[model samples]
Structure formats: C-alpha cells, structure tokens
Target: MAASKKTLEQRGFHIEVLNLINPLESMSYNLLQLIKDAYKQGDTATAQTLCNTLSYSLYYNPNVKDPFWNNSAMSLCNALILAVIDKCIEEKTEDKICMYTVANMLSELGSKEIVIDKQGNTKNVLDIYFEILPADSVAKMQYATSNFAKGGTTRGGIFSTTMSKLSIFTFEGIAKMTSRNSINLKRIGFGKSIQGKGTPRVRVQIIFPDGSKESIKTDTEGRFELNFKQKVKKGQRIHVMESETKKKMIVEVQTINKDTGETTYKVVEKQDGLQIENIVIFEKPIAVFMIVPDYDSSNHVIASIFIRQLYFVLSKYAGLARGGKCHREVVFLLDEFGNMPPIDDMGNIVTVCLGRNIRFNLIVQALPQLKMKYGDASTTIQDNCGNQIYIQSGNKETAKEISEKLGNQTINSLSRSGKGLSIDKSKTEGIDTKPLLTPTELMRFQEGESAVIRFMKRRDNKFEKIEPFPILNRGKTVMKYRWEYLGDDFDTDQSILDIDIRSLHEYVNPRDLIIDFFPKQEEESFEQPEESNVFVSEPKPVPIPSEEDPEEPQFADIDEDIEIPEEAYASEPVSVYESEPASPFEPLTLENWKHKTAEEFFETHRSIWNIIEKQCMRQWNKSLADIQASTMETFIDELKILVTTGEIDKNIYRLINGKYGEVMDSLLEKEGVKEEV
Candidate 1:
C-alpha cells in the first residue's frame, strides 16, 4: 500500500502484484488441479459447480440479453472439459491447465493439457479432436454412416468422450477450424507434437464441398467460425488444411526464355516452419484485478468466479468445521458493491462469517443499489452486517431512511409571553420528541459528516449494542482531507507517510492466504518434463518377521500400516522461532521440574527463561515491561503440555493462572532477583 517498495520492505511486506486483465502469467493458478482436488475429496458437487462457473464465465456478457447464448456456453464448456480429460487419460499425465489456460481454451479447441484418467494413461487433447476428423474418405464415410460413434451398450460411457468433442466441431451442421483439424494430416508424427502445432493463431485453408476455397485466420486460441448459408449435407466434403509458416521469407527468381525474349521474375515465399517460445512467468503472491467502472464487463465474470472460489476455499479451510480460528484473517473490501455481479448466495456467507475470521466490507452509494444487485436478499445481507457507515449524499431516499432509523430525541421547550409590558407574564414548559435530524437536514449535511449505525459489536469475545452517533469530523463541519490539512508545506503537499492512494486497495488472491501449490513457477529457468519409455525392474525382497521379531498386528483396509521411505521423515523437530537453540532439546516434564534446581529448570524451560533474561539483561538498555496476556497464555500452554506429557497429575493451566504470582515470588527469591517494592 505504501508508495515506496523500500519503505514496505523495511516494514516486512513483500509486494508482488498484478492487475486482473492479464493475470494468467502471474497467477499460475492450477484451476484444473483445484477441480480435481474437489473431485478427489469426493466433493463432486464443488467440482461440478466450478465447471458451471467456468461455463458462465465463458459466455457471460453484461450487454447480451439472450439466454440461449448462456446455455450454449455451458454446453461448449462441458465439451472443453471432456476434451481436456480424454487428452490427459490417453497420455497418463497429470493436470496442468490453469484458469487463464481455460479462458483461452474455451474459445477454441482448448489448450493441450495433461489429465489423469481412471485407467492411468497420458494424452494430447488435440488427438481427441483428431479422432472426430477422420483422415481419408473411407474413415469419413464410416463415421458418417454411424451416429457420431459406434454403439457401446449405452450413449454415454467411453463414447461420451467422443460426444462432448463433437459439439466443438459442428454448430448447426458446419464444422469449425481447430488445432487438431489438420496437424499435417498425421495424427501422430514429427509435426504433430503439441509444440510443433501448438500456437493457437495459425494460417489455415478451408476447402468447401463446392470446390471453392476460403482462408480464415484464427484467434490466439485458433478459434474461428464460418457462416453457413445452408446446413452442410451428410457425406459432403469439408477439408481443413494446416498452413503453419515461419516468419522467414526465401527470395528466388524464375527466368523463362521465349521466342521474343527471356523474362526474369523474383518472388518471396514464407518458409514452412514454426517457432516455439515457452517463456515461464512466475506466480505473484498478490494480484489486484480492478473491476473497471465502464464495466469492461468481462472482468465482472472473472471477478465473480474468483470471489466465489475464494469463499469456497476459505470456508473449507477456516470455517466452523476447522474447530478454531485461523492464524490470519481474510478481509474483502469491495467498492461499488452493486456494480459487480452478485456473488451467488452471499447473504448466507454474510450471516455466518464471524467465527471464520473472513470479513466483507461493502461500499455502495445507497441501499437501493444493493437491492438491485442481490434482490430481496439485499435486506438479509445489510441486516447481518454489524456496522454501517452513512455519509450525506444527494439521495433523499437514503437520508430519510437513516433519519427514521435515528428515531426521535426528547427535549424540553419553554415559552414565555408578555404582550405590552403588562404586570402579568405567563411561562409554560413541556417535554416533546422530534427527529434527531430531518431528511432535509440530513441530506444537507456538510462534507466529512457521517452517521454510524451499529449493532452487536464484539469486544473481548462478547456482544454489545453500540449506540448510533455522528462522526462530525472533530467539530461537525470544519474538516479537511489529510493532504489539505498538511497545509502544503510538505513535498507533494501530502502526508509524511509514503502512501500510494492509487495502489491502496490490497486485492489479494484468497489462494495466496494459504496455498503454496506451485513452487515450479518460482524457478528462474525453464525446464521441460522428462520423457521416457521404459519398464521397471523386479521388486526388492522383503524381510519377514520371525517369532523373535514379533509380527505387527493386522489392520483393517484404511488402518493398514504402510512403510514410509526413510527420507520422508524429518530427523528432528524444527523450532517455531528463529532464535531457538541450535542443539536438540526436549521439553521439561513435571517429574523433572520438581527435583531440578532453578538454574537447571530455567535452562530446560527456556521460553520462561528467555523472558527473565530479557528483563534482567536489558533493564538498563531499555524499559522493562510485563508480558502481554496473549504471550503469557502461550508460555502457560507450553508448561501445561509438559505437565500432561506422560501423566496428568493436576490441572496445570488453572494452577498456573491462580497461583502464578506466589510461584513467581518464590522462584525469583530463590534465583536472587531482588524486589523493588
């Protein structure tokens, strides 16, 4: 958030940020793996939901009014999923597709990614499409005669793999161009490698049934469709020619001699080749994808998908199921809350996020905007929020709503009347109630004046109602911004702190909060996966247990013991803090604590020992302070664990909390720590 990276460095925060538009290179988020992880955990629902979300992202456009496009998009999305799956299973490879890859792939034949099939085979995704496009007339006629595929009991098993991909090739009976459409007519050869024909944007030639030719260039994902005046007839010829070419041009001349004279001609032709550049982009810990106001609109789809995924991840990791609060908290500060797409079922998320340590701060012009976005659930979302800040705006509706919520304040009114200096004078006093601030007055509030409506405020793990009040900028109306208050004496006329207001929004990818899944992206060099075609040798012999070496007890399926590799286990337990002892040490137990001297006890329980030394050693150098309640709890917990190590003779935690002062006095007196009062 600070302008100076150097200043942020001094404060111990590494800044690695990227905007939303071009996030794929920097994010390296393996969405493919995330989907599989959900499936692996038997949460097939979550995996399906992710697929559905991607489908919506693929077809969503704020401007579009047609629902048909959205439906078609999901169909296309599933096809892409199957395409990727078949490729991975055939090749016996793991998933390497990411969200960015998916984004580009959804538009075309998707990327050539690795997927794992149940039977364990690796594959090239394009080859699955290659199967759809039969090589010669014989293969083509055979496929046409059949209904897409040969029967295998039912319509949706191994044949379903072919079913999803067929959607990509034919939309209204006309097949489009794909990476696998040509491949130099060789499904597998020197030129058919994923790298050789990998570039999505390639020159291609399409030959129609009428013997007419059309050349259409594809987008980065090699996505392009044709306008079919009529549905293509069955058994008709539609040919796609791969025209991949190198940028290098070769110059040649052709000289022809005739009766009149010899004519020399020069021509330039592109070299028939392709260049591959595999530049690896490292992943960043922080990424800020700005949802532009114009609604670049596509970003909303991406943001919505990202936010939903983030909530899913956080809920699983730190929600009530986690048993306790996480070490760190995640906060979403969303501005223009209404402009963005509605986060699905956000009302439920708002109501139950407290214990999870996940918070959402929504900023909007008024309540109506939220209502527009989330419908009736807007009320649930708003009411669940414990705190609300209202600043004066031109909208009288919002002002009136706040005024009514503020209620009425009681006041005493006194009236005295004496008409013409007559001897008699009458005075009347009465109590009455009136709105704290009328709608008109509320709407006319000065800048920096704001009303705070609060409820169920938590402090010390207890809930209390906070009275609504106005934050009047110290004295109601006479307020200025930090920069204006600076009086223009400072350079740039801003505050002393190096703050970059532009970059203040800390839009962290929720995955960054916990996951470190891709360490490969951190490498400074590019490396290819090792390829091999080899077989494993015979298994090593096992040492059977004899009567002298007692056999282990038999376990049920899941409880069965498996041998772990020697290198897998750590030799020693690592300490939490950097300043811990270099040599190995065991925690002191109650049995040893009772017999040991103060010096020996302190050495073993060094957590307690270090604090004593810090106070005694640095008293002259710095101010000595009592340990914080939190730090004390940690030390006492350590002592309790040691007490419970082998046997639990007593409740160490309660004993320590209750008699700590007396114990401290005795221990200090024995250690010769002189008292000062």
Candidate 2:
C-alpha cells in the first residue's frame, strides 16, 4: 500500500509538462512555424520581430547552446544589427545623412567631459560621445596623433587630456618629484675644496618646492650651512645651484604616507657634486702586538690561560670606556712569541681582535722562537706600539737573546747584580714610553709571578712582570718543575725561587697531608696516654707463725726507764708504739700501700676517671681519647679499606686529602702528634 501511494504521488508531479521531450527539437519546430505564419501573411515587421525575439531567447536561455551570455554578447549583436540597418537606411536615403551624422558625433565627443568608473567603463558626457564615433580607419589615426589639434575627437572628452600636453606635464612632474624625494636633508652640508694655499670656494643653493631659491657662499673657513627647516612634503624639490659654475643639482627627498601606505622618494644625482676632493686615507692597517717567551716550554697552557684571562679583562674594560670602537687590546699568549706558525691559534686571536687605534704588548723570554715563530723578531714588536721590555729570564742565554732582538737597554746581570729591571728610552724610535715601572704591588712579585698590567698612565704598551719574576721561596729560585706538575705543587712554597704564586700557569695538584705526613705521625705514635691514678689506701697486717707455744703468749715487756738527753726529750709524753698502728691511719707511700685491697684500687680508679672527664669537657666537650680514636679510625682505617679494596679512586682520595691536609695536621698537632708522611 505504501509503494502504491508513492507511485501515485510521482504521477501527480509528472502532470506538469513532463511529456515535453527534446527541448531543442521543440524550440526549432516552434520557431519554424512562427516564421511560416508570418511569411504567409506577408507581415515583415512581425517576421523581423519574431526572428529577433527568438534569437535573443536562444542567446539568453541557459538550456540553449549559447546560454549564460550577458550584455557583451547582447551589445555586440545590437551593434552589428544596428550597423546593418544603418547601411540599409543609407542605401535608401542616399548615404549623405549617415556621413553627416558621424561627423557631428565626432565633433561633439571632442568637446565633452568624461569619467571612467572602477570597471574602466566611461561615464558622463564621454559615454554619449562613444555612441557616434566612427569605427573606420582614416578618422582614428588622424585623431590619435594630435588630440588637441583642430578637429580632434575622442570617446571621452570630459576627463581625457591633450596627448602632447599630458606627456610633457607627466614627465616633468615625475622627474621633479623623484629628485626632490631623493635628497638626504639631514646629511646635507656645504663645504669647499682648497687647491694649494689658495682660499677654497664652492657655491651652494637651496631650492624649494614653490620655485623659490636661497643661496650661500662658503667663507675662507670653507664651511657654509643651510639652517634647519620644517621637513619638506612629498613632491617638494630641493635644488642646489652652484654660483661659480651656474650649475643646478637636484636633491633627493622622501616622505611616507600613512593613509595610502605609500613611500614617495625622489632620487637624483649630479656629476659635479660626485667629484669630492681632499679625502684622506690613513697609510697603515690597525695591528696588535702580543708576546710569549721562548723559555716558556710549558706547551702553551700557561699562555692560553693568560690570554683567556686578559681577554675577559680587556672586554670588561672596553665595555666601561667609550670611544674605543676602533681600538682593541691584543694579548699574545702561546704561539705569538717567535718564528713559529703565523696562523697559530694564539696569533689568530691577535689578528681577529686588533684593528687601528689598538694598542698591544707582547712578552717572550727569548728571541729565537719569536724570530722562528713570527719570521721577523726585529720587526715583530714594531708597529703603532713599538715599546718592548726585556725581562730577566731563567738564564743569561735567554736574557741576551731577547735584549739583542729588541735592541733595547741591556743590563748585564738580572739575578747576580739584580739589575734585572732596566728601561731603555732611546730605543723607542717613533714610540713613546716613560720609564713606567711596574707598580710596587705588581712588582712585589716572585718568580713565575706575572701580570699584564695597564699602567695607569701609559697608552702605548702594557707592562708585564717577567718570569724568574721570582717564584720566591725565601728569595731564591726553585728548579723549574714540569709544567703539568707545577699546579700540583702550587702554594706549597716549593723552593722554586720566583714561580708566580698568583698565576694558574700550571695545573696545581692539591697537597696531600695523608700521603706526606699521616704515616709518619702514625709510626711515631706521637700521642701517648698519660699515667693515671684511681686508687685508695687501706689498713692491713701480715700473719706470722707463733714461736713459743701453740697459744702464743703476747705480752708487753716492761723495762726500767733510762735517762735521756735533754735534746732528745720532747715537750709531751712519749708513748710506746706497737708493730701495728693503734690509731686508724696508714703511711702515704707506695711501699706501705702495696697491700691495698681491690676495693681501694677501684675507688682510686673512679677518682682519676672523674678528673679526666672534667678536663676533657673543659677543653673539647668530648672525651679526648674518644675523639682521637674515632677520627683516626674513620679517616685512616675506613679510607684505607676503601682505597685498598678499590672502592675509591686514589685521585678522589688525594683530592680530599689535599683540601683537608692542613686541617688534619693542625688537629693532630694539637693532640701532641706531629703529622707524618
């Protein structure tokens, strides 16, 4: 029942001309029948109208072959059809009327005003003119060549301008506007050039957008100025006219338009202003000088450390001071000393950082490497900063080499005579340096003690404390140790005469008290416990066998009193004493107390224990015995066990010992024990 109802609904919908098959066939048949009827009646207007209407429908209907065609097609068809009809009318009216109408339209178009819409379609009076202009060949060429000439005409006259006049005005306006925008007003200044000793002269002018001009003459000082003015607007011109040459120069100016988001700039160049005279260029490139010593055989580690330190130092100083944009301070640490590779890492730093206005100083113990490294030691230190100092090296060989290379003052003996700190003022040549001594603070230096100090006053070169600068261990030189091990022995006051204490020139391995002294103290047993007494006295008697009878008769034997010397007689009564004491008293002697009981001994022990406890508390708030025992066992025993068992790396252990060795030594010494190796 549902299917039947749906089918009936479909049939109802089909009732609306669903039987109209083949739309094109139907249309063609209908059109032919209409034409036939019109022809049969001989109604020409009806036939024509019917044919036009049919053609129009064919062009418009989307279902037809030329569907979707709009006004362009309609207008084209109308134009052609109108032309055909006009031709027919001309034929009928003798063609004179057509020619007259065309001529009149052309004349009207030339005088009309015109406006073009956004789509390039002309509006206003010009749109009307376009309706009559002839589309023939002869009229177009003649009119196009000379639009403003007599008898000229156009499709749009209201907004259309004369071709010749338009071309001239557009070109002039564009050129003038471009020139005005390109001038840099802020950088503009007037100056003159001088040839020989004669007074310099140049002409200057300022041209404004309103065609007004101002002129100025440079005086003997060769300077002239155009006072500051309000910013010129876009399209405004600034022309500089030379009074001497009567030449004109266009200045460029630029303006930004926020409304239209456009930048209008005028660009112009003059060949005369391009010829600038009296420009000077310096003859030298900016350079920096650095120094490293030949005796510095430490493989450049020290040099690297020093250079890195100096880099940061100079960077910080440069940051604080101004007007040093072109100035640099170069430090030569490693390969810069002498005849080595020029492009070494050390030299690279100098090349990279130094430029003109830069000041530099280099240090090297010997001239050999410098001659070897730099290819020319004589000229190595020669530059804007020609100053060099020959410091006392480790030996005479080193010192002599440097002195000869620098050609500076040579003091014979730096160590023996201690004339190491000498200055040569005459050797400076073009360079200037005062006898600037190293600051007392910096020169109070020991060997290996060096610092690149910027003398407060000196500008050309830096001052460096030279090596054997005395690693002063009691004012004597220490045998130079391996550079790698130098750091390990640092601060040990190793008898190295002048090694620098302040420098991180070499790796310092921390001193280990355990390795050097712990064992020695242990072997000596430096701390021994003091003897103590914790005992009390007690009365006691010895048993002996009876000599006379089983029951020994104990009697006090009476004896007659004998006269005694007065010297022996006492002031009081002298009583007879028995073997055992009558009173409760004992002799205070080890011999007499040898028979003391266990209880007495225990009381003595308690007394001594209390005294020890109180004394320990008074000092360390801990039992001395306990503290000493615990610290020794934990640090030595546990550490030794861990080390022996391979649980702890020796370096780590050594590091700890190095750091706390002094603390450990002091503690043991306080406990009456000298530190042992």
Candidate 3:
C-alpha cells in the first residue's frame, strides 16, 4: 500500500486520493479525538503511530463496493495521473508548456455529463476546452461541426460528435447564444415605444449602479435613446419613473454586457408596466469624433494615443467590410489633424475607405504643417481628398496656389509713354488675358474670404478633373447664428475684449503645471540680501591735479612753423601740377594755390604728407621729393599714394579744411582748384 501511494503521488494521483480521504478523515472524528487524547496524556509516540495507521488505512482501502470503487475512484485517479505524467513528458520534449496540456487539465476538472434524449444512446461526457486556440482553428471547428450536425457525411458526423463531447468553453458564448431570443424581444419593445414622439408625454428614468438616476423625454416620434459615454458595469438598472398623466409608463433596462456582446434597453407603456428589453446584437463600426487644438502642446501625446486607437478601430472595420459583414459607415472628424502621430496604414485606408463607406474629415491648420508632420504621405492624403476648401491664409504660397487655380480671364490693355521735347506719343489698346485674381490679390483677401477646389469623379475616367472657384464670406453668416444662440452681452468689466495681450512671461508661472516625470534640477534663488542699518565713515576724497602739481601734458601745443624735410617735395612734378612747376612750397598765396586740387591740399598737410610719403617709398620705390621738387605735383603724387593705399579718409580732408584754411587756399591755387567747378 505504501509503495502504491508513492507511485500515485509520482504520477500526480495524490490529489484525487486526498479528495477522497479528506471526507473520511472528517467522518472519523472519534479516532481523531482518541489520537488527540493520547498526545495530551504525554504519549506522543503512540499518537503518531495511530496517525500513521489511519493514513495507511485510507490509502490502502477506499471505502466502496469492489469494481465500482476501483473504476470510479482508483482507476480514474490512475488515468488522470498517467495523463499528467504524459503531459509533463510532452512539455519537456517541446521545451514549453503545451496549451493542450492545460486544456486536458481543465477537461478533467471541469467536464460535465449531458444526457441525450434518445433511447439506447450512451450519455455524452463533454470536456470543457480552453479558448486560447487560434482563430482559424476555432472558425474551422465551428463550420465543420455546424455542417455535420445537419446529417451530412459519416466522417463529418463523427467529428461533430467528438466536438460536441468537448466544448471550447467561454461564459460569454453561453450568454450570447442562449439569451438571443430575450434580446430580440427587448429590441422590439423599445423600438415600438420610441417609434412616435413629440416631447414624450412619458419620462424615462435610468437608474445606474451607483444609485444615480437620469431622466429623458422622447422626441416627437416618441423615440428616445441615451448614449453613456462612460463605462457601464453589469447589474445596473434603468427604468422609467412615474408620470402625472394616465399615459405614464415604466421602463426597465439591463446594464450592457460588453463580453456577451449585449446592449441594454428598456420599454414602457401606459397599459403595461416597465419591461426590460434586450438590445439587438449586430456588428457595426463605431464612429469617433475628436477635436484637438493645433496650439495645444500639453495634450499632444494623449491625443496621439486616441488617434492610434481610432486607426486600429478603422482597420478592424475595414476587415469586416472586406468580409461583407460591415453594415454601417464609420466616419472620423479629426480636427487639428497634423499634430498627432502618423496613423498606421493611412495611405491604404485613404484609398480604400471610400469603397468601405468610411470617411475621414481631417482639419489641419495648413498644408505645409501637414506635410511637415507626415512627409510625402501628406501629398498622397491631399490627393485623396475629393473636395478642398481654403479659408483666408496668412501663408503666401498657399494663397498664391489657390489664386492660380481660379484660372485666367481676358481684359483690354492700354499703354502711353513719351517725353515733353520728343512729343512722340502713340496710344495702343489691345485685348489681353490675365489671372482673374492675382496672387497678391489672394494674399490681401479679407479674413472671411475663401477658395474652393473640387475633384469631380467620372465613371468612365479613372482620374478626376479639378475645378476651382472663389467663395466670399465662406460661412461667416454662421457666426450670426452662433451669436443669436449665445446672446451678445458685451457690457462687462471683465469682457475678453478689454483684456490686454502681453508676453507669455507675464501670465505663465514656472511652478504651475510642471510635469516632473523625472527628477527636476534645483535652481538657486536670485533674491538679494537686505542692506544693513550700520553706518560707516566715508573715505577722504582724492584731490584734482593743478598746474602747480606739474603732471605730463595730455595735449601738446602745436608750433606755427613745423619744419618739414625738403625730401618731402617730389623730384619730378606730377601732371596735376605740371602746368605750374614754379609754384612755391611755403607762404603759398591764394593766386598760386587757388587751382590746387583737394588731393594736393591734403598731401601738403604735415601728418597726411608723412604717412603718404612713407607708404609710397615702401610700396612703389617713390618718395614725395623724388616724384616732384618745389611743385604742387609732388603733393599730387603723394595724394595718389594716400588714396591708393586707402590712408586718406574723408574726415582727414574735413579736419584740414577746418584747421588749415590758408594752407589749403595756397595748394588749391597751385593746382588751379576752385571752390566750385
């Protein structure tokens, strides 16, 4: 018996044995009391021996009739144990846990017996199977079984019987199939009650799980429905409240069962009490409308998540449409569209959604912003749009393109041009064509102006032809309706128009809305320390320098006759002063200097003459004296060097004219320079 129990444990049959033995132990309370008494009397050895004896007896002999006990308990246990051992071996061989092994375990534990109402037929034992099987496998199984049950082929029938014996178990499946009739009835009841309405005489009240109630009135046709934006849990009640009139009705609704694919509804009538209705079950693509501001950055990431989810839903609907199962259209109105992450398979959807009755209304700030976010894909998306409307745009490129699309128009042109003396004028008028609205005109359009471009689809042609037109005040009248609804009351101190616009720094606080996903850097405060009240004696003032102090002079006195070297005069006279070669170098009279050019006058100055002479000798192997001797020509040569070297500036001539008027007059006279030509 000990060896057999060990073998059972090794084969995983110990659980079954424990299940059977646990009941026996509870029933044998007197034996347990005797063992406890022995242990309490300080005879632990005897108590342990008694416990061992009880364990041995339970393991060796399970109390039941011969073959019945062996087959139902021992044999079943052995089979289960062997199956587990085989599964473990299979797991080791595969290097992973086989899903079938888990299914087999559930089959053994969760199997149920179903009695077929046929004489001489054996009872069907169905093993509950797991639902982790591939979708194709489940589909194939469902198809084959459904076909076979209708008395098809022998092999198919056998397969069907086998499938019936093992069900792919899901709680939702039972609810979906068994409660279809009830759901249909509820759908009918709700449909009838709401069929005709004008502000429903009856009020429908919905009582949610949290004990909160919402009341709603039916429309003119008596049709009313409530759409819950938030999640609804199971067991929530929805019923119609009492009304004053005899037309009072009660409505009872079941909470929606998402898993079972059930929708909740309620129906009520004056004669009939509140009746809970089961909503019709069918698959339709869910419509989503998202509005996001283009300027909002804080919620961009969150909005991206919504866009991705929307794409996923659309993709699923597309699949359904392909299978000919989709019955309704799915439309997405995405505003500020360019700010979100790229939608997966956007190109494919743009091409395919039209056929599938799925529409995407993408509202973007500008085409460029869209192109920036989606790259070349933006062009493909734009091409797919059947109609495009362009509102007044600050963007020049967009406005220009829009204007050009409006096309050209013919007009008359006239030209006339001549001068007074010639008087040779001819008037010519001819017909010419030009753009109806130029780019500049489009750019200067008012705020409410717009242009429209539409692509008209032809059945015979694969490509669409674009037609463009201009629209003035593109829906500005809608604002009047909005004002009518909101009321125009601007007489308030806190009116938005009265507020002054300032820089972001004035309104934005650094501490507010700080998103700290990671550790933040600490910043030192810039507040200054307070000044001390204690006074200190002032230091003695420094004395200003006086003539008596005798410091070096900052400005030296100029001499009346500063000696300039004779080498400063040129050896050969330059052409500018060649006509007056005998011109005196000093004490120049107005007659001799009057003809001198401004350049000659500049070169005669001491500071400018020295700079020019040095540079000429360095660069051209020519000095002021070598170029011209005792003539205004030498000054002219030096002036050329100064101008060529960019050493003579306008300011130098102005200074010379201001401080050395007489010297300038003498040089001007030598070169025959005059105040005016």
Best by lDDT: 1
Name the best candidate (by TM-score). 1
lDDT of 1 by residue, 1-677 (tens): 22334444444433432234333212232334545555445565666676665554445434446644345445545444533433333333333233322333333322232222434343333324334432542212222322243333322232333333333223211111111111110110011011112236876554555667655455566444332222233244344455665333222224323221222333233434322211111111222333232535534444555566666665654432224343245577788777777676688989987777678888888777777767678889989988777776677777888787767889999998888879788999999999988889878877767766666543433445444453333264555676775433334433324332222112422221111111111111112211110101101111223357554323222212434222211122323232566534343332233333444333323343333333222211212232222233233322333323312223222222223333433344444555433
lDDT for 639 (candidate 3): 35
Q: Tell me the tens digit of each residue's lDDT in model 3 across 1-677.
A: 22233333344331111111111111111123333334445555544444333322222222223522222222222222223323333333221112122224334332332222234232222111112223443212332322233333532344333323123211222112211111111111111122122234566664554566655565444545443222344443433443443344443445544333456645544344433333433222222222233564432332343344334434443453324322345456776676665554455668767765567788776677666665566777888877677665677776676667667788999987788678798788999999867878767766556666665333325455533444444455322343454333322234323322222122222122111111111211111111211101111111222356534222123233554344333222232243555544333443444344434444444554553453333432444554433344333333323432334442332332232343433344554545321
lDDT against the true structure, each candidate: 0.42, 0.31, 0.38
What ranking emerges by TM-score with the best candidate at the front? 1, 3, 2
Q: Which residue pairs come into collision in candidate 1?
A: 20-289, 88-115, 89-121, 90-122, 91-121, 91-122, 91-123, 92-121, 92-122, 93-122
User: What TM-score, over all chains together, does every model reach?
Assistant: 0.41, 0.17, 0.30
Per-residue lDDT of model 2, residues 1-677, tens digit only: 11122233343311001001111111111112233234334554544454343323223322234322232232322232233223323334222122112222323333443222334343323233223336652222223322332222322321132221112112221112111111111111111111111123765555666766555555455444443222455566566566666655564446644322234444474544322122111111111112233553322222232233334334433443333322322333333433332222333334434532233455555645444443442343333223334334454544443333333323333222223475522322243332223333233435543322221323324565433221223233333445545444333443223321121112211110001111211112122212111111110111112244233212122123532232211122211123434533332232322343312222212232332243222322334354333432232333333333334444333323322333323323444543223
In model 3, which regions exceed 4 Å deviation?
Answer: 1-299, 322-326, 417-425, 431-433, 457-470, 474-481, 485-677
Tell me the deviation in Å of residue 489 in model 2.
30
